[model samples]
Target chain A: MVPVLLISFIPLVRGIYIGFTDYELGGQISFSGLENYRIMLQDRFFWRSMGVGFLWTTVVTALQISLGLILALLLNQGLRWTSLYSVLMLVPWAMPPIVRGLMWRQIYSPDTGALNLILTQMGLIDAPINWLTSFEWAIPAIIVAGVWGEIPKAALFFLAGLKTIPGSLYEAAELDGASAFRQFRHITLPMMKPIMAAVVSLSFMWNFNAFGLIWILTQGGPGGLTRLPMLAAYEEAFRYGYVGYAAAIGNVMVIIISLFLFFYLRVQLKERTS
Target chain B: MQRLISWILYYKGFIIAGLLAVLIISVYIAGEMAIRLESDEIQTGPLRFLSLAWQEEAVAVVQEITQDWNQAHPEQQVELIQGTWNAVHDYLITGFETGDIPDIFHYESAVIVDFALRGYLADLAPYISDEMRDDILDVNWASVTRPTGAVMGIPFLAESSIILYNLDLINEAGVIAPTNEDPWTWDDLHIAAKKLTKDRDGDGVIDQWGTAMGLRNSANILMNQSIAFGGSFFYYDEQGDIEVRVSKPEKELIGNLARMLFVDKTMSPSGVGKSGAEMIPGFLAGNYAMVVGIGSWARQQVVENAAEGFNWAVMPPLKAVTQNMGVNTQTLSIPRSCKRTAIAMEFIQFLLSSENTTRLAASDWMLPTRQSSLEDPRLQADSTGWKVVTANAQFLSTGPWVGLPGYIEWKSRVANPIFQEFFSQRISLDEAAERIESESNSVLARYQVRGLKW
Candidate 1:
């Protein structure tokens, strides 16, 4: 308990303290009293990154949940190759995020990337798309790569949730002349709500703080189109040597995440009580 | 006895807490003793020298030099810790903060001022001999000297940007071959680039680009180009006043660069968001006929990585209004935290001696900073590519604003983004130039207000 408090809580408290000061690496530290926050509020890059973070979280979470649900449902159907499919589905999640990011970076390369080659061979496009370099395509390309890596975990969660849904409920639905679609809508959908909520909230938190994947892929480039808040905070801290300002950005991120988690949990609690 | 047992049980929690406190205190004492014993053991050993020379050849050279030093002075052994260039800066900064800085380390010359100003590096002027100072190149020496005339580091190797081109492609495109004596002008290079850029497969899209212009060092390149155009962002006046001059030449250079990137479209589009080091693959893949602003040290990598039948040659850097190139030097410095400063300086002098410097430079294909090493027969050989590098080094100038405190911020935040935006056509050249000037001035003002000698 002492070690935990010393190692973790001390640094947490120090970081919070530093956020209120004008501290820089190798420079004098003095309390500036809300100066850093004021600058953050006015900084366009901060707001832009926040917007990007929101979009990234929303898009990646929605896609991962949908794809995970589909895969989970297929795997739960007692198919002949269900075991084999499950192992294959876990490959992406098992790989390191940095390695996955680097692989996708090559796959998205404009000249020699696999995506362009496949698209060209399939008669889908006449020209090779600059997936990583284009402003319009960079974020979407990153999202696709992120979803590929995130789906396996989400699928596993839904799979666990599927196990808990009583087979007897589906059997009763089938006896009631309900079609497969009706059964899924009436039985599966309602049964998966709690798991879906957990998955969505957890995925949102993870994707919001996702750094390695996007950093390796783009380093927040193509004119800062993919510059999420985490990347911005990193740049401020390490590159710009604005440690205090970066700490403030981090504190704000925590507050934002907490507020999101708060409302989410509140809703879940209300649902449970009702 | 029964009454005493009941009383003890009633105070059990307090007794447990007291015992726990004693246990923690004892462990702390043991840990402190162990640390002290270990440190005492280390204190009796040799001085530590850290280096960011992780390349195979570079590491071999450093090992050989250190071994020779260790043998000569058995009592003053040197333990060399090798690391990569990417991690060295963070390592040094953290080590400094923790009061664990290595006695000696190699760093990029651009950051010498940053460290020196922070009172991390010791002034090397007193330790360096006059003969040794004279042996080093003027520009190389200037790179390590702080604005206060304190020499903070000793330069080891120097490099500058040069253009690499495929002779076959230049011949095929009917472009004039650029030579060290008669390098092509910016206009001449642009015309050749347009001609060399081809759609060989007739697919209505350019399959082969004329050149790749690396945007990673865009700020330095911009400063070099500005100097070539007879303008500079910062310069020292006769009275030693550091003047900030962002004017017409820099703006014109930006306009030309934007046109080359967007309108001319001769350069590779894939060069966007990639550093100079990262663009080597595209060059090796035959996607580009020429790669501009490639450093002298990258020649080996290019040769090794290029596909079969690939042949390349170096040309003197491009000339605009003048023949100038930006020189970047790698240097070694003894930090102020070093306990054995004299011994560390002695080892540094030995490492940078004529024999060792020549060996390392020859092995790595780098330009030696020492005059005698630069004049070595191996470096002077026509086939070694050092002849062109040395010739270009004659016009070497540390680009204006390199040693500034806010230079890193200005480059990463203002200059690089503006250049990228301009290249992508998100903003016009005029607006980029304006923003670059204003943003750079703001950074400068911030540093000045803090009384930094950047």
Candidate 2:
């Protein structure tokens, strides 16, 4: 415990402290109170990235949770090849994020990509669509890739939650002349609310901080349409050598995420108390 | 003895655990000793070299050279660590911060000034011999030599941008192919591009593009073109302070590029986002008639990846107002963190020796920096397009991207985004130039505050 604290905690605290200083990589360090934060507040790129980060997180989380729940419900039906389907669904989650990003990048290639070839062969369009290059479509394309990669994890969480629900409640509701939809609404959804909230909140936080997938795919390019705060901070620290300013961005992100987590914990506590 | 045996029998599990622990420790120590003995046999502790030459052929060449070095100097073997070019800079920076820097390392010439300014690199001027000083190209030599006249690194390989054209497309289109002696001007390229672009199926959509320009290094390529247009991104004042110069000529260059990409539509639609890697397959598939702004080293990639029986030719860099090419030189430097600077210097010298450098250049299709190596027939052979590369080398000018302390930030943050926006037609050329000038000045001001001047 002592060694772990020394290794991880000390650096984390030191990094937070660095937010208050002017610490360029390999340059002299000096304290300039609130200067980094002041610059960040006025920086249009920072705010733009924050907006992108929010949109990415919200869209990806919503899609992932919805798709995950649908898949969980289907898998719970005990259909044929359920085992095979379950295993196959986990494949994307099992793959490394970087590899997934690269794979999707190839698929999204404007020329000779699998997606373009398939779309063309289907006569869906007369020409290839620039999935990653177009400013209007780049973010949505990345979001699709992110959701595809994240759904399995969310499904697994919902699957566990589904298992904990009492089968007797559904059976009783059905016996009382409730339809499938009504049973799910009155019994399943109410029971799954706590788990759903937790999953959504956790997935949102994870997606907000997602870096490798986006970095590998578009590199936040084609006019910074997909430049999230994490990538912006990375560029500030490594490319620009503004370590202190990057740290302040990181701390700001932490504060925002903490607020979300705080509300989530409150909800969980309320549920437990009730 | 009887009492001890009885006690051991009473605590049989403890006795067994103690014995197992002893056996494991003994085995580990023996293994360590054996490894040490093996290393001692080769005397494997002289210089540690971290190289960014991870390409298969480059790695093979490095291995062969290291093997030769090991055999010739049995008492002092070199340890080589290899990484890809994309990840090496971060690794080098992290190594510097953590005091885990290798004795010698390979780096791109663009960031050598930054590292030297940070005091991470040692002054290598004293170690260079007069013969070596004479053999290295003047521009290559000047790249590593600081204003104070201290050479921080030795140039290993150099490359400049050239045009790779599909000869089949050129012949089919009946456009005159560019030559080393008389390369196409910007207007000629535009006309040729229009001639070469075709719609084979006649479905009102073009199936083949006349050319493609990669956006990954678009800023540097734009800088090269602006230089040819007689523009400078920056200039040093009499007091050696840097001033931003992205006004008229830079704006004109961006406008021309925008026309080529958005208006003319002769270039591939993928030009806005695709990297060189993504663009190469399309080029090989005959989707692009020519690939402009490709480094000389891409000749090896073209030879390996192009379709069988694909006929290709190299042309000298295009001209606008003047003919110039962006020279990208790879170099080796000894870090100040190295305890064995003398040995590291020796190893670097060995690596950059005429024969070794020639072998490396041939393997990677890069231009040799050494004058003696440049004279090698293999390097001058027309079959490898070295003739065009060598001829164009005369016009080699390191782009404004080099030697600036905040160059990476300026290029990636300010220049790249603005260029991308212009390419996407979200912003006009004038707006891009204005924003680039202001943002670039802001970046430079940060560096100036840190006492780094042009």
Candidate 3:
């Protein structure tokens, strides 16, 4: 506990302090209260990236939960191939983020990509599209990759929640002539609410803060279309050597995430109490 | 699990004795390691060299040089550390802050200015050998030195632009070849490119492009080459502070490039999405009649990877209003905290000697900064257009990006995106020039009046 606190808190406190100072790489740090934040407010690149980040987080988290719930339902059906399917679901989660990025890059290649070959054969389009580089398709393409890599985490949580649901309740409902859909609606969803709440909150937080996967895929290019706020902060701190400004960006992100989680949890608690 | 526990209990006495034996052996080994580590600390550790050479040929050259130095100086042997060009700047910055940096490291000239000005690099002037200093070009020396005359690093290899063209295509198109003595102007290349472009199958799409350049991350190349059009990106404003500017001359190269992509339809539009090295395969495959890249890439990629019976030649450096090309030299710097500074300098001097610098630069396919190496017969050979590439050294000059505090930020964030936007025809050339100028000035405004001007 002592070691963990030392490793974690020191950096956290120092970073917060840096947010209020004029800090650069290997340069003198001076107090410049709220100056970095002032610059960030006026910076169009910062605002654009924040917009992109909000869109990415909302789309990716919502899709992950929906797809994960479906997969979990299918796996719980006691099908013959359930074991094999369960193992297969783990593959995306097992591979590291950097490896996933490289794999997707090759798959998105214009001339030799598997995706282009598949699409061409299916007569989807006349010519191959540069998915990652295209202004219109880049966001969607990365969102798909993001969804694919994370579905398994959400699926595992849902699967565990399904097991906790009492089998006796479903058995009692079936006797009352409850259909499969009705039973799921009446018994499964309500019982799964607690787990859903946990997963949704965590997933939202994780998605907003996610950096490695998107960074590997795009590096926020083709005109800053996919530059997430995290990438923006990284550019400020490391690429441009604006440490104080970068730390302020980071502080803003933490506050945003915390505020969101706070309101969401409060609503969930109120509903549970009511 | 319970059965396994019972099974283990049955062999408890023997297991206990075995565990004791293992513990004793571990302690002995630990003691030995501690002694060795203490001895190493007293000896001040091996001089660590973090080399950023990743290509097979480049890595081989670095290893050979390190091996020779290590063998010659057994007492103060050098240790080779591997680093990548991608993460090197951030890695070195943090490493220096934590005092965990290698004794010697390799980096480029433009980016090192930030590090040098921040006082991370040692003043290598005291340790530099007179022969080595005089042999290296003064411009190369200026790259690693501060505005206050503090020498921070030794510059060894320099990269400039080179055009490699398909010989067969040039002849078939009836285009005259350019020579070192008389280079083609921007207009001449534009016309030649139009003639070289072909639609072999009579389809609406062009099957062959006149030339392709990996312009995606080539902001430095674009800015450097823009000098030929009398473009100086940074200047002192009315306040006597460095500021960004994109006048008509600065826009000339980009304007012509946009015309090639959109109006003339000679240069490959796809080239703007890829890197310079990525265009080599297309050049070799006959998709492009010519390709533009660093001089070293000519040797490292085309000369090495070209198919049998496929003939290729290097064209003279392109000229617009002038023949100058911006110098982006690679350097070796010692951290101020290095324990074995003198020994590190010895290795650096040995690695940067006339013959060795030539060997290193030849491996990477760039120009050696040393005059003696440039005069050597090896670089003057006609094979692979070495003469044409070498002749380009005469036009080398200091780029305005040098010693500018916010140059890298402006290039990557402001300039590169505008270049991409215009090249892709999404934004007009005028829009690109405006955005680059305004946004880059805002980026540069964060620096001090005299910051990194060296």
Give me candidate 2's interface root-mean-square deviation: 5.5
* Residue lDDT tens for model 3, A200-237: 88888888987888888888987788999999999898
**Per lDDT, what order, best first?**
3, 2, 1
lDDT of 2 by residue, B290-338 (tens): 9887778888888888777999888887777778655667899988767
List where candidate 2 sits over 4 angstroms from the true fold.
A175-177, B1-44, B237-240, B399-401
Tens digit of per-residue lDDT, candidate 1, span B1-454: 9998888899999987888788778877997888678556555678888877755787898999999999999999999998787677668877777666778888878777777767788888889977789999988888888767788889878877778787788888888878887889888878988998999989798978988877744776777667778777776779855555557777767766666777899888667656777778877777788888777777777767777777778888778888876667889998886767887899999898888888888777678888888788878765546788767768877676666777777776777777777776777766776777666666666566667674
- List candidate 1 stretches off by more than 4 Å: A123-130, A261-274, B1-44, B234-246, B307-309
Q: What lDDT score is found at residue B173 in candidate 2? A: 93
Error of 3 at A245 (Å): 2.4
Share of native C-alpha contacts between chains A and B (below 8 angstroms) recovered by candidate 1: 0.36
Go through the candidates in order and give each one's C-alpha lDDT: 0.81, 0.82, 0.84
Error of 1 at B386 (Å): 1.6
Task: Give per-model TM-scores.
Answer: 0.91, 0.90, 0.90
The DockQ-derived docking category for candidate 1 is: acceptable
For candidate 1, lDDT tens digit of each residue in A53-77? 9999999999999999999999999
Better of 2 and 3 by DockQ: 2
In candidate 3, which residue ranges exceed 4 Å CA deviation? A121-127, A167-186, A260-274, B1-43, B237-239, B293-295, B449-453
Model 3: DockQ against the native? 0.29
